[model samples]
Target: MSNDGHPMKGHRFVAWLIAAGIIAASPALADTPTGAARELATKTCAVLAARVDEIPGSGPVFLRSYDSSFGQGPTAEPALANAAFTYDNALAAIALTACGHRAHAQRIGEALLSAVNLDRAGTKGRLRNTYRAGAQTQRPIPPMGWWDVVASRWFEDPYQVGTATGNVAWAALALLTLSEVTGKTRFRDGAAVLAEWTVQHTRDGQGPDGFTGGVHGYDDAPQVLTWKSTEHNTDLVAVFDWLDRAGAPGDWSHQAKAARAFLDAVWDEASGHFFVGTTPDGVTVNRAVSSLDVQLWPLLLHGALERWQRSLTYAEGAHAVDGGFDFNDDRDGLWVEGTAQAALAFRAVGRATDADRLLAEVAKELSPSGYIWATRQPSISTGLAIGPSSATDDFRYYRRPHLGATAWAAMAALSWNPFTGQRLQPVRVRTTGSK
Candidate 1:
């Protein structure tokens, strides 16, 4: 649990220096390369800091995933109110580490630990997709809910309370990052618990030979999801690899290999892109749609340049929108988070100019409230459903100030890779005849 290097020194010191005006401001705010990144990172930190738990020594806290002003009006998505998504919180934790706020980041990590140890269903190794935002109460942890005056009962969104493999992986990644930076065994142990649950519950030898979507619906009768996602598996590749290196008690190296196998299977060498994932059967490849994240995330892998370098070019040609990128290949409008992912991918590939251009576009997404918008349009579709009960592709992103988007922008600006807890390194080239 000893720190190998001071993660708190470099970026953290620089950010503090910037705040104190010790360094001259970069030219043309949000225009120059470093200026755009600095602007994004500074604004993101300001917004996130405002949401920190005010009380000293308070239990872990979850930052509300969106601004309160979002879920209003007749067309309101009320379920979002006070819902702290695990994915966003995880991203925020990693972003906080990059921004030099390890204490604040650890609070969020403590919240994830709460989720792990005190799940509402009393499950030992499970976490919901979302939890009630703010300071933690006693165990079993509370699920997100609000009073429904019309129904005269407390209502909770099924999707919010459910566990998704991708979200869980993200939480583990966040914990692993905190553990790495803080050298805290508890955070690493918590991540291992989540990874154990994933390997036990979701791993599949079905068509794709990877992990499944995870459980959905209510606790009493949770539906086991069978669909396998390239994105989710991509996440697992990193998680399992980290666990393997940590020498956790499991076949994590094998788990990582299986996840990589899935990634390799779904890779379309002819098309130069990855398929979305498998269908509900878990065996049949679901090539009906293409997603932006699936294309960009894999490029963060160590040997990505050797195997999937073309994916970067393929993503740009297909998903680029107004200098940003979209959630899906339809390219309906800009998805801020995905655009940030693309920026990091560009950075990973040593295309600094490409990264700078994408970042400049991302800088424009800064909302007046200091958070970034989820999307450029009023709404944008992802061609996916909210849950198993949904009949249509109702999943969409609104033009709301989003914690996830802001966190991603901060990571991109700081050149940090959420998966690795290190700055994004150029994709490694394998010498000929190398393993």
Candidate 2:
């Protein structure tokens, strides 16, 4: 028997070991859609369609950024101006697709490709606040000598800032979605790189985890800027999940192992919670104690193990706290928007009753722009009003209403998730020859 004819048994043993590892690892969850879910999606899709840009090479979105005077003005809607970051575009892309606005999402993908062409803007793009005094903002993707700037970041560039994990992961997801839509290998390859980097860096800072912080294992060692991230750990897990499921080969096994390890370390089995950021001593509950009804990160990342968030933090004056669920941080209670997002997450894991109640609140007060933002509620904290690294604008962060979070909340409300709570399908409201 020739030795070269037979494959090594040791190699087969390694393959089995890897397979066992993946099987033992946690799996990312999926959601199905229904009536109200479809309606919310349908309305949101209509809004995106009305507002999207129909350009040639760059499928740029046409809208405006929020102005303080008008927290979300006509000009504040997404426009060509805010299309640079991969993360924003990624979430927007997936939400649009979920809402059935596939073309609009594709345009987002195209615009991302075109952004690579802008030679002047570097990692910061063409933002007014960035690049002081005539500095060229756009640099070639993977600027010649710099080490961490990968071809994907240079090419896709999810968020305007390099360190934003949400941008990196979400944008990568959007690209993966695009690859699914367009049947292209390029999108898949680029998305894989970004996803790998996200998982690697989130735990140990292997691939420039984007945020310029000394963020260590569950530690808030804010390195670059003091602007903290409550969602990076929870949200970036989404990247690991999508890439893992997508069969992204290179370094995926390692990335998955690292992410699993990091998540395991942060989960507090004792308190039945997950620490958003570690206190200096590691056991103190300085960061956050529990999950919010509105916060979907816990649900999305961990699939809501009954033991972790089976408990609820309820609002005052409620009747025995019937709708209690996931906790809200920053002292922000269960407002309509937060409730709606909570409903969305619940729907993801077969909690339809909760989803209906949450979506109902949004529908009752849904604004003309297809969203809900209450200005008078003193009990609740506005979600999106806090600017991205706009710590300098602390007054605005505290005083103004949550604008960005409102948009996201609205998006979640309108999404169609059959797996949410118990799959409350959208009521089919058709307008056929009705005046």
Let me know the TM-score candidate 1 reaches against the reference structure.
Answer: 0.90
What are the models' TM-scores? 0.90, 0.60
lDDT of 2 by residue, 125-164 (tens): 2111111111112333221111234443322221222344
User: Candidate 1 has which clashing residue pairs, if any?
Assistant: none
lDDT of 1 by residue, 1-435 (tens): 002113243346446546755233222123324467776666566556555634356569888888766422222456777788999999999988777777778899998987887676767779999887888866877877788889899887888888999999999999999989988878889999999899999999977789999999887788999999999999999998888787777888888988988998898989899998999999999988889999988888655645576887888888888878889888999898999999898898789888888887887776555567788777888999988999999898887778999899888988888878887778675533211
How many residue pairs clash in each candidate at the backbone level? 0, 58
Task: Output the lDDT of residue 295, model 2.
Answer: 35
RMSD in Å for model 2: 18.2
State the weakest 10-residue window (summed lDDT) of model 1: 1-10
